[model samples]
Target chain A: MSEAIKDLLKKNHMSVTDSRLQILDMFYHAPGALAHADIEKKASDKIDRVTIYRTLQTFEEKGIIHTIPTADNSVKYALCKDQCAEGHHHDNHVHFVCDKCSKTICLDDVHVPEVKLPKGFQPHQSNMVVNGFCSDCRS
Target chain B: MSEAIKDLLKKNHMSVTDSRLQILDMFYHAPGALAHADIEKKASDKIDRVTIYRTLQTFEEKGIIHTIPTADNSVKYALCKDQCAEGHHHDNHVHFVCDKCSKTICLDDVHVPEVKLPKGFQPHQSNMVVNGFCSDCRS
Candidate 1:
């Protein structure tokens, strides 16, 4: 886990510090993605609150992790899985937030269907989030 | 239109006022929904910025509208088809945000499927947002 963080930091041109390692660990352990509050609770014993926030920002800048928006306007994040840039990623798949566990998981293979837009609008990045009860929670 | 807002307000026991009506109007005309920033842009000219904010807060509290989390952590509001409590709603369907025109549209018919959760977790409310170039913007 630590090695993964180090590699990510090095690749992203960020410092592979202990604080960042712990924060990255949270993402590593997370089956899907997580909210700031989730990271705070899970990683508080290792990383400080401010450091986690900074690490998230830094990781996002390096394209190591990408932000996934939810229904509450709270920013959640997941690992890039090697598809992100300093300013963007072509993450055009469905993002699932489990209502059962409150965990945000990226549905990489599931793509959101194309929508019709109005004129004079340029295409940019896109994101898709689906919220519902997970299979485990339902059972 | 005025009667609609009045009816919503009265049913919810909220005070009916112009600012509230205007803010509600934006949500009404909005095919998807509007962010606070979007609301301010359409409404600040007629209502006080603070008033708009307060009215939105009240509307959210009273179940008139609900918050949708976006990729940037920006809060988006949509009028609930059925009255929803702060954390409860019957319309837990898919929501799409067009990257080209920055529009949030309700995909009420597009329902999200179930997910599998880890243990010891409770599932509650959920929000789903799909961001992409709308059909018009693509053209």
Candidate 2:
């Protein structure tokens, strides 16, 4: 898993620093996308707060992760699939946030459908967030 | 237009005050969702900053407006149609954010496609945001 993280960072031309490695490790084991607080809690004193924030920003810009917006205005992030690169993100799929557990997950099986805009409205890409109860929460 | 604002506020069971009225008027005339900064700039010397923020939160809870989340982590809000009332919002349609002008407009005509999640996932509501160039920017 650590090797995979290093390779991904190298592929994206990012330096394989300790902070990036630790953050990647957290995402690797997470059941779904994680909020800033979640990441901080899991980091558990190994990393500082500001560094984690900067690392998240860098990862997002590099397409290593994608932001998931929640109803409460807090943001979460999930790993990007291989299809996502520096300048292109083909990870435009539906995201599901569990109301009970507050887990934000990427529903990879479901793709965002193309919407036909009215005249003069040109679209580049889209995002869809579905709020509901996940399997674990329901059970 | 101001009278319309007062009536809408009253219909939603909110106290029709000056702050609420001015904010509603801003949304009424907005070409698309206005960020907090956009609203502040347009509010001129009429509304204070904290009041505007509180008013936005109230309006969102009352279903007078819906938030549109952008990639930059800045949120924007647009007026809801009559279909949206206090405690209910039928504005589950695609939103278009112009890359050039940063205008976030509701594509009320394009409804969000229902995605049948894998077994155990139950969906309640969804929001779709599309990013691209707007008509004005394209021209």
Candidate 3:
């Protein structure tokens, strides 16, 4: 767990702290992206929910993670990509929500396409979510 | 107003209703996009919030509109593209959240780029958001 946090910190160029490490590891080992409630439940009983919330927010601000909004409007979080440029928010990526497991998985490799905007409007990035039943669900 | 509703309904192949027409035109005349709250605020107070919520859900189900999750986690919705297919939802367009106006505008013509997904995962559609000060805001 510590190693996971260290690696994440190194990748993000963030100074490693115990709290950041714990939160970073939580996201790294998470098989699927986690919602706020889920993170609070599984997080160490010692960590306050508000602390976890703040941690998540800080991580997002630091570009260590990004959010995925599900059909149910629950927000999920996942690790950012290595290529995510510094000084920029996390690069937009695809998020997959599996119908069977109801798991939101980050398709980090998947990049959202560039879009052409109307006059006087300038576009910077994009987010894409693909919703469907997964292979396990179909089976 | 009735004709406008009729045209929107026929254009999107959705059923026309007082609430639906009001909601559609509310979005139509909106400079950018509208939250349910924005719709309520801009339109007559006669439409109940519950009704607005239900109507938005119906519109989403009908592929007439899609949602953009704001930084604050509130949803902002707008009209979809012409090719919006039934039973399928694609909001893979550029969403501009003007820092000045604080409005979310749907860039219909601007489309996100195609992404290649990882093995065992299928990519269907995506949503892209660009957050920055709009031209007006910059000015």
Best by TM-score: 2
Instruction: Write model 2 residue lDDT over B26-105, tens digit each, in one string.
Output: 88888888888888888756688899889998888888888876655678888877536667777877888899988888
What DockQ would you assign to candidate 2? 0.73
Best of the candidates, DockQ = 2
- What tens-digit string does per-residue lDDT give for candidate 3 at A4-122? 56876777667777667767777778888978788777767457778788878778877777777664567788877663454466655677888668888877666666556666765
For A24-126, candidate 1 gives per-residue lDDT tens digits of 8878888888777888888656567787788788888777788877765677889987648787776666666676577677766666555433343333544
- My TM-score estimates for the predictions, one after another, are 0.69, 0.92, 0.74
User: Residue pairs in steric clash, candidate 3?
Assistant: A113-B112, A113-B113, A114-B113, A126-B128, A127-B127, A127-B128, A128-B126, A128-B127, A129-B126
Query: Taking the candidates in order, what DockQ does each have?
Result: 0.32, 0.73, 0.38
The 0-to-1 C-alpha lDDT of every candidate, in the order given, reads: 0.70, 0.83, 0.71
Q: First chain TM-score in every candidate?
A: 0.86, 0.91, 0.78
Name model 3 segments beyond 4 Å from true.
A1-22, A44-47, A69-73, A81-92, A132-139, B6-21, B69-72, B81-92, B133-139
User: Which candidate order results from sorting by TM-score in descending order?
Assistant: 2, 3, 1
Positional deviation of residue B30's Cα in model 1 after best superposition, in angstroms: 7.2
DockQ for model 3 equals 0.38
Runs in model 2 deviating more than 4 A are: none
Predicted candidate 3 versus true structure: per-residue lDDT over B1-139, tens digit per residue: 5696678687777667777777887776778878877878877747989999998887887787777765446777777766466667756665678766787877666776666666666545555566666777665
What C-alpha lDDT, on a 0 to 100 scale, does residue A72 get in candidate 3?
Answer: 54
Give the winner by TM-score: 2 or 3. 2
Q: Which regions of candidate 1 fall more than 4 Å away from where they truly are?
A: A44-46, A116-123, B1-4, B11-15, B25-33, B37-54, B57-63, B80-139
